[model samples]
Target: MQITRAQRSAVAERITQLERSFYGRGPSNVKVSVSQDVPVSLVVLSIDSLTAADSVLSARGHREAVIRHHEALHDVTRADFINAVEDVVGSQVHAYLAQVHPDTGHAVRVFIFADSGDSRELDSLDDRDD
Candidate 1:
């Protein structure tokens, strides 16, 4: 099983949309992809410029503090993130894994969907002509 290009784009667009509404403004770039593993649909979203402000603070020797703050911020908004992903994927979100790499000035959002419509079955209903 593989997550098609259509699925990839759909997830990416949703993430981009969330940036403005959730984070004040969209990131510089958002890359999204899906891994076709068994039993679940795993989506990985790489967000650039997500940690920019924190990175600047990190350079001032408060890296740990900034990192902790980032973690707490995400925790506070985790529910909204999960809901957004679920809406785009049209499946129940089983798990949401979020991480920020301040060293790299990037963040990752992974959404694992509880098996909803199987890939084979979703091919027909997903908004893809293929």
Candidate 2:
């Protein structure tokens, strides 16, 4: 499925809210870039980089809950959805780094890069790479 920028913005905003609620403050010194690779049917949210504090936050149990919420919002499921959700949450910590530094130009990307019946393209790049 193709998630629009507006949708992504909404997700980002929610993520920010969640981060604020979970932590007294959001991530600092990092950027979160989210992109959906349609050919792979996957959502890729990259962090500009990481800091010591960011690393610490990622090591908490609540972090797993956050990822579950993220995947649940998108209705994603796997053979072991619970484990998958936890993994997503762990991965998402990096994205929150961007929310903490919005002016840094790193935003998270979400997309369905591949589907059960869709073709997969591994090398087609997006504007973020430029």
Candidate 3:
């Protein structure tokens, strides 16, 4: 299943807005894509140029601290993130995986949608026009 440009833009904007509202800084770049790497299709959201404060911590040899902080923040806001995505995709998320690299100021959020037994090869969604 190919994702529409509007859907991608909406998802990216929602994530950026959430980051800015909660973290006081939004990612400089956001890319949303659908993947078919698993039994169920997945939504992959990649964030780039996150807050510079994280880089500062990494430079000061506090990378672990930054990672921990980000983990805690993700834990606290997982529901909101999932909800934002669900609202856009109209599907319940079965799992959400998030990771942040403090040194690079990049993050990835992988969402696995609940399988309805109609999985489609969506890895090419990013390559096609909706």
Candidate 4:
């Protein structure tokens, strides 16, 4: 089923609320988009202005620290995020990927939904060398 704009907005709002409740702060902006692919559907959440500490740490030449902090926090709160997304999308998320940019203090969270049809097979690396 195709995701609707209202559903996307609802997902984004839920994510924002989760961030605020879990992290004590929410991003300055949040965007949610859906992409339908061959084997699965992807719901992507992009966030801007992660945190004030990100800028401070990056300015002190501890950019990696900022990234690591976000990653660790995300890991700890993974289940909460996954649950919120699943609730809004009304589908089980098979995989979740998250990343943060040290310089820009931007982050992206991708929720991969299960496929409802046969998946396309990919060629092996050896086949590509032929």
Candidate 5:
């Protein structure tokens, strides 16, 4: 289930592009980590806390909203595997927002798990063990 170096590089490049589009630049505190066992790449956004953003998504009754968002993007960018990774990262932002700002109702946190042979999975904030 390990992702190839080329795949990871492609995903990273797409993520960099996505960050520029969304935040006007990569997050100052954003961190990217890759796992070979799960064939997953994690884009962690450092926030002060989760209550501020977490509350929004929770209040909206959209536990898996982040995951769905990423899946949509994944489907849209059929040829670009990196797009899928960006989707997952984008989804995580929302999940993290919800987790950090529970009262704000703006969830943000995107976790992308890529399975063998180009398969990708997105998990929402609620889905996270933490």
Candidate 6:
């Protein structure tokens, strides 16, 4: 099934709401888009003005720390997010990806619903020996 613009907007609103509910405030703005290819559907959100001073510090000299921190924040909210999204799109989210650019005060989140065989759960996994 294809995701409609209204549904995408609703998803974006829910994300903003959840951010507020979980973190006490939402970003300055959020934009959401949805796309699909074969076994998985992708929901992407572009967030603005989301860089916390602490997160930026973590980003500057400790890239891994920042990524983990970003993941942890998303992990805490994943249940509500995945449930709401699955309900909206009528699919299960097999994996989720979240990223932040603290220097730019921007963030991106990618929700993958279903296991598309070609995809990588983590880019590092590509280097593992078969």
Alpha-carbon error at 115 in model 2, in Å?
4.1
Error of 1 at 51 (Å): 5.3
Kindly report which residue stretches of model 4 are placed more than 4 angstroms away from their true locations once superposed: 116-130
Tell me the TM-score of each prediction against the true structure: 0.72, 0.31, 0.79, 0.81, 0.34, 0.70
TM-score, prediction 4: 0.81
Q: Order of all candidates by TM-score, from best down to worst?
A: 4, 3, 1, 6, 5, 2
**Candidate 5 error regions (>4 Å):** 27-31, 38-83, 86-130
lDDT of 5 by residue, 86-121 (tens): 443442211111122333322234454543344333
Error of 5 at 16 (Å): 1.1
TM-score of 1: 0.72
Residues 1-130, model 3: lDDT tens digits: 3446787788888989899887888888888877755534445454554567777888999999888988998877887888888788777667778888877777888777766753322323325545
RMSD of candidates 1 onward, in order: 8.8, 13.2, 9.1, 7.5, 10.5, 5.9
List runs of model 2 lying over 4 Å from the truth: 28-130
Model 1, 1-130: lDDT tens per residue?
4555776677677677666676666667777767667556555555554545676787887778776876886777776777666666667766677777766657788777666543432333335545
Per-candidate clashes come to: 0, 19, 0, 0, 38, 0
Instruction: Report residue 49 deviation for candidate 1 (angstroms).
Output: 2.7
State in Å the error of residue 65, model 1: 2.1
lDDT, model 3: 0.74
43 Cα displacement, candidate 6 (Å):
3.0
Candidate 3 clash pair list: none
